[model samples]
Target: MQTDSKTIYTPFVRAKDSVWEVMSDVLLALIPCAVISYFAYGEAPLFVMFVAVISAMVGEFIFAGIFLKKWNTLLDGSAIVTAILLAFTLAPFTPWYVVAFGSAMAVIFGKILWGGLGRNMFNPALVGREFMTVFFPLVMTSRTIWYNKDYVNFQDLNIFNFLGNGGFTEYMNSIFFKPSGAIGEYSVLLLVLGGLYLLLRRRISWHIPFGLLVTFFILLQIFAFKDIKFSLGGILLGTLFMATDMPSSASTKMGKLYYGAMIGLVAMLCLLNDVKYEYMSYSILLVNGFVIPINWVFKPKVWGENINLKERVGAGVLLTIGIVATTYALVYLHHFDLVRYLIFAYILIVIGRFSFSKQLH
Candidate 1:
């Protein structure tokens, strides 16, 4: 009976295959982006991609050899995924060394230093992007985002020369569909297909992705994302590339939902304020950094998990008590002005999901 039970549950935990599944899935998803990059920025995208991917793979192998004292994950394709992902986020004209530096930081500091693969606190791609932001701000921010600008950020290191000479609309269109950059990110259509594949493959859960999409689109439509006319694509991009991080995101369904909502909330605020810096990558990394602590403390009750009415009331009471305490403290600190939304979010989150239906047997 125990063995049977174990067999039944194993698929839920591990999926049908091993780590290579993820590596290949990510690579397959990246193909659209690569094709688009080739045409838009010409050969520069390919060249930069090659450098970035190779650097990331080599970095991973070296780090594993040094840190693990063995060859685990060296050829597992995770590094290739990381490399391609990092490169995908970059502009076509970025410098080769910049890619190498970012790749190294991603594999070594972001991943390997934390005992590798499943143990890191944030996404490796996010780490590389953030490292690029801090260490080489010019290149990351200077490269035009495939369109809307004619020139690279004067501060960039210029990894590829061809991106400097593309037509604006042509480049923009390439970003939308034509094979252009990295392996898979350039074409939005292909990204969606790949995302669907992962969903069906059960490689990731929908809770966080749905949470991210609904919250982001609603908030963006409500506040700042109005320019896009209620498009859920941005959040989709985040879900596929950023927030689905198995290690950093919440582990339980409820936990992942809450985590995704929090990220969406913070990112909406950022987008609303017109954060002139790198938008998607920066927001994703920030959320990734915050998820570690949130998950540690916010485990949710299991389905069929019992909740005593008395204990539930006690929790509500505790929350009320804490709010009251906070109100008093804020009063003393002259920060009471921030309490207006306190009641609103609490009421909605706690009260809105309730249906008042008959309890099912």
Candidate 2:
């Protein structure tokens, strides 16, 4: 009952783009954000990024020597991409050692241990960022770390006050010019442009990011319209750069859409519960576990492959049960209660199905 793992690497059937080219393009796209961070925060952010990149390269080199026993794959640029991304998720003043540790963890545990690059199930950068957040919450979330005496706070602009109401100004600031945040998420404008560059280069598809943004926008409008301006930068950064990671994300067209929507739903639920700093990263990681199953469920029909009517019926039944549980939980219980209920129901159905198959055998 296992799905074909090889088919889940990416959706590109015949693209001539190499991994190095794509990674190079990504790094190019990130240059403007990096420059903005450097200008705003002085040399601290640059040092952090430099340390992370070195740490990642070293980790990959050592792992390649030991496990892979081949050096050529190290030139693919994925390690550097992972390193830059991990650094982007950190505060500008993050300690050098901490940045190095997180970068190493990202390369060694998240990527290498999972068989590297296209075989990994989760985003390596987010894996590193999550580790840092868990182990160094004080360092990661320190308000003082976000401040730079050398630069003016963009949120305190007089023109912004005259632009619109307080809420509108705040929303615009969050989307366009947040003075304080992770190094790479300073401006949603730059991120959107970068995402567009990737799209134009044919390095990534629009489905995953589009699905995630649209779904999250709908959810906010429905349940928490007032807090719409709260985390626009984080949402945009994650949806554009991290969640769209090809190897760790969904492959099939429909599966990619559902996968992204699921991430959005889980993220909104996390936000509703006040899990702000880790919501987007945690949501992506959570959905990574389901990508294989999602691909299986939405697999394209092959010409000669047999279709299991009984299995299809069982899946339909599970879908029906999930819908009913969602409605009941959303109406009568906490917002997160729907997730818990669905998990419980899914576990029961899986166990029951396994037992039934055994009995038949």
Q: Which candidate is the best by lDDT?
A: 2
Q: Against the true structure, whose TM-score is highest?
A: 2
Q: Over the stretch 181-243, how does candidate 2's per-residue lDDT look in tens digits?
A: 788887777888998999998777888887888888898889864554455667877888899
Error of 1 at 158 (Å): 30
**Candidate 1 weakest ten by summed lDDT:** 1-10
**Backbone clash count for every predicted candidate, in the order shown:** 18, 0
- What is the C-alpha lDDT profile of model 1 across 155-239, one tens digit per residue? 2222334446667645544435543323334566656776787787777778887887787777765765255332233445667
Which residues of candidate 2, in runs, are more than 4 Å off?
A: 1-14, 150-176, 225-229, 304-361
Residue 294 in candidate 1, Cα distance off native in Å: 3.7
lDDT for 281 in candidate 2 is 80
* Model 1 regions lying over 4 Å from their true place: 1-16, 143-185, 224-235, 296-361
